[model samples]
Target: MEVGFLGLGIMGKAMSMNLLKNGFKVTVWNRTLSKCNELVAHGASIGKTPAEVINKCKVTIAMLSDPAAALSVVLDKDGVLEQICGGKGYIDMSTVDPETSCKINEAITSKGGQFLEAPVSGSKQPAETGQLVILAAGDKALYEAAIPAFDILGKKSFFLGQVGNGAKMKLVVNMIMGSMMNAFSEGLTLADRSGLNPRDLLDVLDLGAIANPMFKGKGPAMLQNNYSPAFPLKHQQKDMRLALALGDENSVPMPVAAASNEAFKKARSMGLGDMDFSAVFETLKVLKHSS
Candidate 1:
């Protein structure tokens, strides 16, 4: 099937590449058009504008960085709305607030396009291997229609009933992930400060109930202070902020998530925003305290 893809950031590029490798015809667009070169070399077409891609493909999927980018690509001049019409499907796989997903859904549906919000779980390695878990909602038909592509992009996909559900699920998942990372950082710092090897601590954690992919995947790299961007710190902080807002709207107190957001903010303040979210480890590591 022919597909249109937007936002060629880390996740976007990998996803679009997977489609190309799977023999799907994909037309892509990005704000910095030069980012399209890599995909073009892999046998993908380029669209001069978001509208152009939508006009040329029946299914257009976007994996933008944030809600603003997601909205701009669809609402700005020469955007998706200009070409979206009946029989066209638009799926936004960006991590955003439920409200943002709702806004995009309304706009697309108003223009006779099918809309789906499908934010994924997992980072760079998962994205590259198509092992991410997708949380999808809005337009069940569209979700079903996009399954073939989703199958290639993610190992699993869920249909969560409404437009905002997928976004909410994604935020909640990321919030918990941020909180866990914060706690994990504290453990590592405490272990090292107390003369215990952090590597030993990771091994212990890996043998226990909390053993999971994230800690195992990030622990060693973080120990070497490898802050390469997979899912960037700034984006994690943005998800935390958006998740906290969702909590506020529902009158729920998210103390852990709020604290995690603060840690992420501190890391960003240290110019670690472009680093991986695990770079928040630097914040805890650098804190001056007496034992």
Candidate 2:
């Protein structure tokens, strides 16, 4: 099937490449034109605008950076909504807030276009390997119709019943992930200050029931103090804020998540937002010194 893919950032680029490798005829666009050059080399067509992509393909998948960028491409003048027609499908794979996704859904469906929120759970590596888990929400018929495209992009796709649920699920997952990462940082720092080798502590943790992919993957980087961005701190902070808002709406107390959100905020204030979320370690270091 032919597909239009937009927003060729680190994760988005890997995802679009997977679609092309799976032999789908792919048309791609990015705000920065250079991001699409590699895909163009792999026989993917490049579009100059979101309208161009929607007009050219049956399905348009967006993996933009944030809710603002997603809305800019879909609701701006000559945006996807303007170009979408009946029977066309739009799948947004960005990690946006539920309210934003619902607004986009309303706009798409009102224009006679099918819409699905399919926010993903893995980062660039998983997207590169086509092993990302997709949390999808919208019409079941459209979910089934887009299954092939979903399969090409990810190992599994879950139909979560309505437009906003997928975005909600993403916020929930990221909230837990952010908190876990912060806890790991605190433990590692404590081990170091107590004269235990941090590496050994990581190895022991890896063997324990508390072990997780985040700990295993990010531990080595923490050991070496490398904070390159797989997932940026600002984005993690954004997700945490959204999750806390979700909790507030439901009258649920999320003390752990609230604390984690402050940790991320402190990290951002330290100018670590452009770095990996692991840079939360730096904030923990300052807190440790203060205490």
Candidate 3:
């Protein structure tokens, strides 16, 4: 299958390369043309603009940073709308709010293009290994048409039945993830402040009922203060903000997610925005000293 891939950020780059490696003919584009070079060397074609990619492929998948970027790439000049016509499919795998997903859906379907919102779970390692879980919704036909590519990109894929459901699922998942990271940060800081061995704390957590891949994978490096950018802190904060907005619209109180969002905001303010979302641990550690 020939595929159009827009965005070449951490996730997009990994995903497109996986497609190319798996024998799919892929065309890629990025706002920064230089970012596409690595993929070009891997036997992928390059598109000069979003429209060009859309016009050239049966299915175009986008994994952008946020809702703004998602919308801009579609509605902006020389964007997807310019070339999305009947028989074309556009899948936005970016984490965004339901509203944004619906807007994109309406715009695309109105132009006779098929639209699907498919936001994924898992970060760098999962993306690279094709172990991410896909939460997809919108045109069922498009979802079916995309199965081959989705199978290559994710370990499992869910068809959630509507354009916005994928976005909602992704936000809820991210909200829980962000809040758990906050609580984990608090626990680590508390363990250290009380003269407990943080490594021992990780061991106990691993042995306990709450054992998870996230804690297991991120704990050791986090204790050593390795705040590398697998999933950047600022993007986590943005997801938190969007999740909170979803809560507000539904009259639901998300106090814990709100608190986690604040910690992320503080982390961003402290210049840790470009680091991994776990970098919020640094913020909690700083808060202890400030208090």
Query: Which candidate leads in lDDT?
Result: 3
- Residue-wise C-alpha lDDT for candidate 3, range 118-162, written one tens digit per residue: 999999888999999999999999999999999999999999997
State the lDDT at 255 in candidate 2.
99
Candidates in order: C-alpha RMSD to true structure: 1.1, 1.2, 0.8
TM-score for predicted model 2 compared with the true structure = 0.97
Candidates 2 and 3 compared by lDDT, better number? 3
Off by over 4 Å in 1: 289-291
Instruction: Provide backbone clash counts, one per model.
Output: 0, 0, 0
| Candidate 1 lDDT, 176-247, residue by residue in tens | 999999999999998998999999999999999999988998999999989889999999999999999999
Better of 1 and 3 by TM-score: 3
* Candidate 2, poorest ten consecutive residues by summed lDDT: 138-147
Q: Pairs clashing in candidate 2? A: none
lDDT of 2 by residue, 1-291 (tens): 899999988788998999899889999999888889999999999999999999999999999888899899999976898899898999999999999999999999999999999999998778899899999999677788889988977888899998899999999999999999889899998998999999998899899998878888989988888998888899999999999999999999999999999999999999999899999999878877899
- Descending-lDDT candidate ranking: 3, 1, 2
Top candidate on TM-score is 3
- lDDT by candidate, in order shown: 0.95, 0.91, 0.95
